[model samples]
Target: MCGIVGAVAQRNIVPVLIEGLRRLEYRGYDSCGVAVLAGGEPHRARSVARVADLDEQVRETHLEGVTGIAHTRWATHGAPVTNNAHPIFSRNALALVHNGIIENYESLRETLRGKGYEFVSQTDTEVIAHLIHSLYRGDLFAAVREAVQQLHGAYAIAVEHKDQPNTVVGARQGSPLVVGLGEGENFLASDALALAGSTERFIFLEEGDVCELTLERVRVADRDGNDVQREVRTVAAYGGAVELGPYRHFMQKEIFEQPRAISDTIPQADSFDASLFGDAAAKAFGEIDNLLILACGTSYYSGLTAKYWLESIAKIPTQVEIASEYRYRDSVPNPKSLVVVISQSGETADTLAALKHAQSLGHKHTLSVCNVGTSAMVRLTELSFLTHAGREIGVASTKAFTTQLVALFVLAATLGKLRGHVDASLEADYVRQLRHLPAALNSVLALEPQIIAWSEDFSRKENALFLGRGLHYPIALEGALKLKEISYIHAEAYPAGELKHGPLALVTEAMPVVTVAPNDALLEKLKSNMQEVRARGGELYVFADSDTRIVSEEGLHVIRMPEHYGLLSPILHVVPLQLLAYHTACSRGTDVDKPRNLAKSVTVE
Candidate 1:
């Protein structure tokens, strides 16, 4: 949940390292720091704030060096303070920056303390600096290798030694690391985006691989310190990483881009031409009698939504299972059954393991819907659908979820057409409507200012209820998730018809009920449900189609959407809810991007 970047060059590279850190800031960070080796001395500057603050600090301090390692930290073992910031230094001032949790650091810290090692900070990362210093045998690479050998748990580490001024050492185990190759320089970062501007050529470091980088070359080795062969892959860089561009946050940019992503998936709807899903997947799905979906978090919700689409549209018997729970369950899948896994990162450990488990059970027809191209999940699956959501930075997912839904919807529709359940005209109409989603999404985005005004009431309320019927019930659930994830609000969603059975008891005058009253077959029933909430003295906020003349009376607030887009209305309706959540969280002084106790990618189960 932290960002790490390093650079080794023939000329001063502090500026490049700082720029890289700024690029990676969207990953979420509490503190920022950089350690540069110049004239055989390490100069480190760190601060507890945004990367800008650290950049200002570094500028004020004038830390110039040709070799450096930087980190933007999301605190794990220590509080967010200057002392706890990364680029944690050894006793002699050689600095180390690390990503991932060092699970055995407490024991290791105690061991080091017993040996009279003085620690200046309370971070698990600081232990590595001390360990390297203590075990220094003149070779920075050897020292880092030895220190890493003594360490335990997941890490992507970048270290710079004061005595060894011309080199930087990087190692990875269970965490991501990449080496960017440039003329007369080399860059190291936890992600390719961090090195976007510097170079497109990258050597993706695999698990247990370590590299020693100098201005001229990068040498790779295994955990056992033996020489290892490596392949360099070229990455496509987009200028989007450098600027937000017409959007306030990356979340907003991504949200507005959903229509395009959906459109892209729709055109290739029935054509599974991607090599990731081969003949095996086509054959298996052609003969399969059942389908199983395994996923977690928002991906799991996407699967749940797909279960509805698949069952109704394709007449397929489907089951959606949370990946974390799927492993231990005594559930079984036959060779004639297809297992579909959905994940944004596809590096999510539990989901990846679940895919492996399903494969081991002889379920040969495995498919994955993932965003990352080279992720382990994509590599392991027999077939994969790559979501074109681009980069989703916010911990609370917005665009990725919607894109996953689009992919699933298209998949279901494709299956229906293939099975002769849908006609050519129906397919053409679906594609036409899907193409118009972008413009419809733009219409929804225009409602943000109005939604923000309504957020004033939500900011004061402790509890909220989101209600929808049928397809929109899932949309309501997703809306509630956004509110709770970022705003820290006590929010729940229920099918509007189910209110009488239970959940209505929680309704009171102080409570706010947000209803997704889209003009559909269930519009009248949803209006009745709203009336039920009003009878309980609950204040209401309704997102309705312009034609659904829900009267604006006492204790009621209605924001009429421009038009009714039918089945695609859920995609548009969710925009106002996302805005409500974002504004509420902003007003409450909560972290909208990186909510407390949450990580962007669930790499661990």
Candidate 2:
């Protein structure tokens, strides 16, 4: 739910901590702070502004040290203000930043109240700082272990002590924390991406694991005080240079990055062997008679689209579930089913929990389609298909959705071929069609100008309805999600046939209706649905195929795509919707990339 970074380095670690928090800004925070242990005290600066503002505060205060911890707070227990900011001190001995909720903080606060301990801020995290300080016995590591034993909930914490300036202690129970290996420095962060620029070597902590970091070495141990050997693996740097070179916002840049992202996901889509999924892919795909997809947010809509592909193309019985809901519900477990989890950041809390749920239920076959290789999803799953959509920084998700669809499409075709549901000739034809996607995507991106113009009009409206049929229904859902997420517009999507059931009553002159029309068998039916909206005086914003004949009229508006793609049409159709949401958010003067109350990754449940 929050971002944390701690560094013990030879050179000044303040700049490194700032950069690490900068990379994690997409995690959605309300305030930021940094604390450095200097001259037997913590020199700290905090702000209720962006990280840049906090950096300026650090400079103004001259807070400099080689060992420190920094945090970007996503407010949970307290409001986003300076008093509630992190890097909170405890009896002038230690400062700590925490990432998760303490379920028993009220009782802990009451207990500490009688121990002659005074409280400063209304934060659950400050309890940990004081609790650890109360248990101090000369060793910071021992103090943190004792403090964590009394805690009752999930946490990923990094601690720094005034007396132990060269040492940092970290522990994780339910949230993610990693140790970065460097020549003369060691780092701790909630994600490896925070340390991507400085180091590739990392050690990922398991549940109930704790680590002590120093400038010379990193020591990892489990909860029982026994030393543990965690593997140190090298990872590729994530999201190289997240600079807005030409685009207006990160959302705009990510919207335009779809073509490249999709292309990178499947460079050899035409000739890609089934082995792209790793050595066990063929065996796993052959054994599974059913497929279950678990995901959340935009990844959930991608799962919905893949349901169409898996059933029709692969001829497999597929069921899609929202990860958060799926884990809580009691569902039948089919051992033969392949449990697939899709996430841009592999650390999504609900999806990872769902994967563990399926695993605990004895569903042997499992796979993960994820972007971050170091994520919990990849490490826990039996098989994996890694997407090359590096560092999707936008909170609303532009390129990640398209690239996930690309990965799922590849999975469908590969499974179809292995199951004899598709002939080799037809599969070759599908692959050829897939090859046309990148270029087809480029042609589709050219429609942005038209979408921008449409946004100028639609932005004034506060409500919108999206309509689609068959496989494109998921695209319509995603379209509405983008609109509501970025533009703060009340938007809903329904199957075209459901218009008469209820939603048609909401259509009016002030409400714009967006229709996704491809030249499929359901085109005529979708047109009829659009007519119903037009008859209600609802302004029609139709994203039509190049030759669908859905032209512009008085109450109707249209943006024609370059060409018609058959099964891959959803991938192309979504691009314009992303542009529409981005431009509309721009028109309304809303935050496009980092919208209100949304995080790039849901690392906590």
lDDT of 1: 0.83
Candidate 2 lDDT by residue in tens digits, 1-605? 58999999878899989999898998899999999988888888999899999999888877899999999998888899998998889887799999988999999999998898899898999899999999988899989988899998879999999888899999998789999999989999999888978899999999888899998999888989789999999888776658988888988888778778877887474554668887887787778999999999999999999999999988999999999999798999999999999999998888988999999999999999998888888988889998888677789998899989989988898888887778878888887887778898888888888888999997898999999999999999999999999999999999999999999899899999999999999999998998898889989989999889989999999998889999999999999999999899999999888898888888777
For model 1, residues 280-322, the per-residue Cα lDDT tens digits are 6556568877789999887887888788888887899999898
What would the TM-scores of all predictions be?
A: 0.88, 0.97
Clashing pairs in 1: 277-383
Model 2 TM-score, all chains together: 0.97
User: Can you tell me which runs of candidate 2 are displaced by over 4 Å?
Assistant: 238-240, 267-272
Q: How many pairs collide in each candidate, listed in order?
A: 1, 0
The all-Cα superposition gives candidate 1 an RMSD in Å to the true structure of: 3.3
lDDT of each: 0.83, 0.90
